[model samples]
Target chain A: MEPFIRLTAVAAPLLTPNINTDVLIRVEPMIKVPKGKLGPYCFEAWRYLPDRSENPDFILNKPAYRSAKILLAGLNFGCGSSREPAVWALADMGFRCIIAPGFGDIFFNNCFQSGMLPIVMPVETVEKLAKLAQSQGDLAPDFTVDLERQVIVTPSGEDIAFRIDALKRRALLDGLDDIGVTLAAKAKIDAFQANDLAQRPWIYRY
Target chain B: MAASTLFEKIWTSHVISDLGDGFALLHVDRHILHDLNAMKSLVELRERGYAVRNPELTIATPDHGVSTLPGRNIDTVPEGAALLRGYLEETRRAGIRSFDMNEDGQGIVHVIGPELGLTQPGTLFVCGDSHTCTHGGLGALGFGTGRSEVIHVLATQSIYQKKPKQMRINFNGTPGKGVTAKDLILYLIGQIGADGGNGHAVEYAGSAINAMSVEGRLTICNLSIEFGAKVGMIGPDDTAYDYLHGRRFSPAGANWDRAIAHWKTLPTDAGAKFDREIDVNVANVGPQITWGTSPQHVISVNDVVPDPATAGDAARRDAMNGALDYMGLTPGQPIAGTPIDWVFIGSCTNSRISDLREAGAIARGRKVKPGVSAWVVPGSQQVKQQAEAEGLHEVFKQAGFEWREPGCSMCLAANGELMPRGQRSVSTTNRNFEGRQGPGARTHLASPSMAAAAAIEGAITDVRKMMV
Candidate 1:
């Protein structure tokens, strides 16, 4: 996993509510496409037309937003399925941050593992950012998300505060492997298991 | 100590250490895997030089990637053959029990867990699929985890989780005639938008929930993820105990008596407080179905497509318009009588023996309408055997419905069984997201009997009309 510190890039605005994981990457490509190779298949349904040509109407397909690294979205973004490939697809496509009113719980957690930041902002605030991004098109000023400072620097030079779980923020900053950290507490886990076995014998017997 | 809710009690008991900031390292009692995710974790563990911490507590099956065709083999779905083979070999190498496609215990992970007694009250269960919450119907704390978390569990048998707030939804009255658990849950999802239960662990209570069969409770809990709750559970009672008695992995002899005593103390105590509460009168909710891309775009069968012009806000209106265009639906048109080309009567939500029986009752004397391809894929091999012995298969077969083997067929379309593009289907599956069944395959979610009725009429028909 890449360590996330600070990033400055163009932001694409897709204001549709309830953009589920299914929309991020369909099931066929999710199963068949290997990791790091999912960039071409991201949002396949909306990204491509019936004849396999790029859908010109999609926000990401527009020339102004083709190189965007940030997504400004509406409520309940990534709301369906626990498929982690959805996050992989977005990361593969060069997306490093997403600003939405809310997010599905599992998808929210999956983002940190892939070095992608999911920020929950007020609906009004997100809509305001999206409006600004849309109004400027290719000339839209690049937005900066700084993890250490825990703020998003908007195109208008205003700093918007955000909060992430302290442990998660640290993990992302350092690109720490979680399993190695947990395995360091082997003694504590073994002790807990030994004590628990006596109280719930049936759990082990099964 | 103060009184505790069912979720509180289960969560407290499973905690190994508090990592602070509302996060804790939890001891997982059971870990179930399927072909879709097991191989990834196993390969990662091998690469990292870590053995499975507790192979005895882990079990696997090939469900999502295998075909449901009669006498199906790993190669039946050629695209998924490598995954199925890798899953079996890895589980065998790790000394974990794995049920193959032809095995008696093999089925959808959620279905077989409860059927084989691997799920029990007061246990914390984790799986790779979101519908793992189905085990919570048996009074367990079940939730889905991602691939990295799967590897974490394999190596340490523990997961770090931020405790979720508690919410209880009470179904206070009896369901009306022909209204099933599927309808009750769908109605709730419609009431509370798709993300209403986000970040909360939900508990189902009151008279309606208490009166439901265990299978019905499973159906209700299976869709918790669809509504944005990772965990959904019910307090175990005599119904759950009766259902688990004498099953394969259930406690026996003296262990049964002790296990029951512990489980009896697991329900919420009087005066326990929840962060939020919602009460519903099940008597008023009719058969429900989705009309759009998301699960929350639902209404009773008697209602019509809502006009986007009348929506409360511009965002919602745009969403409604997009859904209408994709579904090829006209505003103000009745949801009922919408033409459907396929009827899928199986999924983790509604593919149990009871679900099959309900669909069989509707299909017994009616033939599927011409040009509509209908299929009844059982939840598990055991469910299939039980349905076959009860002659449900014959009824479906006689009614022109294909009675297929057990797997997660067409639910996620992982096994290559999918409805063609530009078609519509009435599916018993939980999700109705865009392209869920296939590209351009519009789906309307409903109960098994409702799906069966749609097959017979070649359109979306109210199941109540054919209940008798």
Candidate 2:
């Protein structure tokens, strides 16, 4: 969409694994869309996202290091519940890259659709990347992920090989997502809908 | 040949088209929304100037952010309160039936549907909440949805979905004295692992299911998502009909007769086939809790967590080690008496009036431990009101518990009440994954009575003795 969504940044270490979408983003925040407003609430809110007028201490506001485009996470990231707002929050917040050892079944799909590259690596690789990112803020711990090479290169010239499903790899490389996939089958879908409705009039009356 | 199961009958019956690759254009009959997802759909409606295709088909309620602390009816939580108020105003303006906290008609969306008899046999019920499957206890097809699908349903009253395969989970034999429906479902999760139902719609049947009460069936179906099912159901029966007999929105005198007649024929045929069938012995299940992240990483309170070396599968061992490290629990240690600092017994999953009553029975004359902080919250203002009328509030308050108003409190701490970072809690809510309660808060999922007993003991303890 943006000529290739590449997020070069210092890694923000998120040690927690199996983070549900609700934790990474939030349902209450996604519902209050005034248009592309989720970037602020990506990790915000201890309670519900406070009224835009009221200031609240959100999780993303902690004083350690802020505004990370690259998130280095522990194994089994984005697990537990299947709330999708987490993906929206991260993508909307300009975080286009996430490196983790594993992802939940549903959250993984949700992330791919939003153009967030969820790179799978060994747990030790993620741990090493997290350590590199935490120590060097604004140091630009370079992770230039070359799809052709299928490797993410670090600032220190270390190469991290990543794995992605062949189908998902094509979807990402071609930028063909859910909407594109659905629209590609539009003709077939229309004919099927017509025929099925003709056959089952009672079910398709609506 | 594979035989068509009850799920196949209902699912295929509703299909308008096969979109290929397991996707289908099935029809949704009744669409429901809560405060959050409803508003997103409303904005989309105003943008396209689309009038709802069928207003009567949609139901809206303020459950997720509805205030639970009684008398403090004022909006306290910022975004949730204002958003809920906006949902009430807009839905009322649109001529849609909207339930607020003050409405005796209001409660958790799933709790209200069956109680009011709006959830009926052979219907397609969809909401924006995961536990929408709770309605399937009455032979309806119910499940959660995404924001985009919510928008589609809001505009056209129809949404496209993939048809899931069928699975029938049958529990036979008499449950022991301490065993409840929650125990059965938890034990099932432990057996099947988290992704077990990833592509199935489960139908719970057999003798043990027949013995479960309406409330118990709701609890069972409520956790179907934990096993990865798109939906879960129990065929409508006398128990479901009886529970729905005289609620505010239930079918009245004449409609009741018609409803019952229709519900009577909704059961599966003797030869109905399932894509998969699993059997459980109700007698073997006991009070269960998660010692690790995945619900499958569970054990009986009296048993120790299995060592990784003893794990049968590589994935199980990996999950076991991961959960143990995150939860700070060691392998082979007794989970019972693993001291907890807090106990919270309320959520959409188990915050109904019946759950409160069960906890009340357990808490009668028992003082909570001196250091433990515990609270009992109803699912809805109506549940709160009913509990008060039944003197269940006194039962909770007399047991050194805080009787709080109902919204999803501490369930995710989205309401401002937290279990503090790194503290452990015995909760009646679903999921025990890390930071599910707070940044580092540890959660132990349990039945409401078990939660009450843990609150009293300040640790994991068997709930059977407190039953009497």
Candidate 3:
């Protein structure tokens, strides 16, 4: 996991809400491909035609947005499926930030583990960002997502506030995944397990 | 102290450390893994040099990425062999208990955990698959995790987490004829929309829930992730206890008594406050069929397709229009007569023995419509054998429905069992997300009996009309 304090990059607009994990990373059965090799398959069903040619209409396929590092999306982004490849694909595509009205519960949690910033902004703020991206059309616009400040700075100099808990904020700044956090609490966890084993021995009988 | 919701009660007892800001280090009582997605996490763990903290607490099976064909080996499908071999190798290396293909206990992760008694009341469980919430039918705090979190759990036997707010959905009336727990959940998702349960753990309650069988409860809780909830549960009761009494992994003798005593206290306290509440009357919730892309786009089987112009907002209208365009349906058309090219009767959602019996009853003496493909993939090896022993397989076979071995077959289309492009299907699976069943596949999510009813008539037929 990489530390994500701040990122200023082109933001691709995918206005459709409920953009699910299956769309984010199409599941290919029998393909033993690793997660790092999944970027090309991100949104494969939607991003490409049956002939294996890129769908010219998809925003990510356009020349200006091809290198987008931020994704500005609509409500309920990353819904459906617990596949972490959805997060992996976005990170592999160099997207460090995802701004949306909200995100699916598991997807939101998965982002922190991968050091991707999933920012939840007000619907009005998201709509505003969407409008900005749309107005730019094929020309991708740059946005600044500052995790330290907990704000998204639009291209037009507006600072939109977003809320993230102090714990997640620290995790992002420190590039700490869940394992790192758990390892840090090693003493406490060991103590709890010792106490729990004494109290509930049957649970460990497996 | 205030009365605690069922979620808070279960969550509080598992907290190992309070990280503040609502986050905690929560212990996981059980962790489940499957062949399709577990290898990546295992590889990462190996790279990190972390041995599993307690291999005894974890279980692995080949479910999501294996062929469900009878006598199917990894070579049955191009990728099937490698996926199965990987599962066997990784589980062997990690020392975690695994049920390989053709094994006695091999099944969908969600189905096997409860059937084997690994999912008990008041404990927290996590799995790589989203439908793990099915365990919550027994009052466990079961939910899905991504590959990275799976690695963390294998390493520490716990997960870093923030507690979710709680939601309680109570259904008061008895279901009418032909309605099942699948219908109840589809109706709820349609009522609340796909994102309505976001950020909350939902506990199903009221009279309607209490009357349901454990299998039905599992069906309802299985779709919790479809509506954005991470955890969905039903408080354990005598029904749940009866279901778990003699399962292979269940406690015996005095241990059983102690387990029962603890589980009896797992329900929500009286006057408990939930972050949100919704109440619906199930008497009017007839069989539900999703008419559009998302599960929220569902309507009663007897209702007409919705017009995009009638949507609440522009975004919703666009969503409806896109769905209509993709699904090839017309506004104000009756959903009952909408043609379906395929009917699928299995998934973690509705693939238990009772679910199979319902489908079998409908398929008996009825021929499948010409050019319509119908298939029944049982949820587990146990379900498959039981259905076969009971002659349910013959009923389906006689009715022109293909009876396949259990796993997540048509539900994901990851194995070679996808519906043809532009073909609309009435499926017993959870999500109907575009291309969910396969590329260009149009799916209408429904109950098992409803799917069978469609198979017999070649279109989306009202299951109530077929009911005797």
CA lDDT, every model vs. true structure: 0.92, 0.72, 0.87
- Pick by lDDT: 2 or 3, better one: 3
Clashing pairs in 1: none
Number of the predicted model whose TM-score against the real structure is largest: 1
Model 1: how far residue B26 lies from native, Å: 0.5
TM-score of 3: 0.97
Off by over 4 Å in 3: A29-31, A135-138
Clashing pairs in 2: A45-A58, B68-B405, B68-B406, B69-B405, B197-B228
Model 1 ranges off by over 4 Å? A135-137
Per-candidate fnat, comma-separated:
0.72, 0.02, 0.64
lDDT by residue (A66-105, candidate 1, tens digit) is 8899999989999888889999999999899999999998
TM per candidate: 0.99, 0.79, 0.97
lDDT by residue for model 1 over B1-468, one digit each (tens)?
Answer: 899999999999988889899999999999998998888889889999898999988999988878989978878888998888888889999998999889999999999999999999999999988888899899999999888888889999999899999999999899987789999999999999999999999999999999999999999999898889999999999999999999999999999999999999999999999999999999899999899999999999999998899988889899999999999999999999999999999989999999999999999989999999999999999999999999999999999999999899898898899988989999999998889998989999999989999999999998899976
- Highest lDDT scorer: 1
lDDT of 3 by residue, B114-143 (tens): 888888888789998788888899899999
**If both were scored by lDDT, which would come out higher, candidate 1 or candidate 2?**
1
Candidate 3 chain B weakest lDDT stretch, 10 residues: B78-87
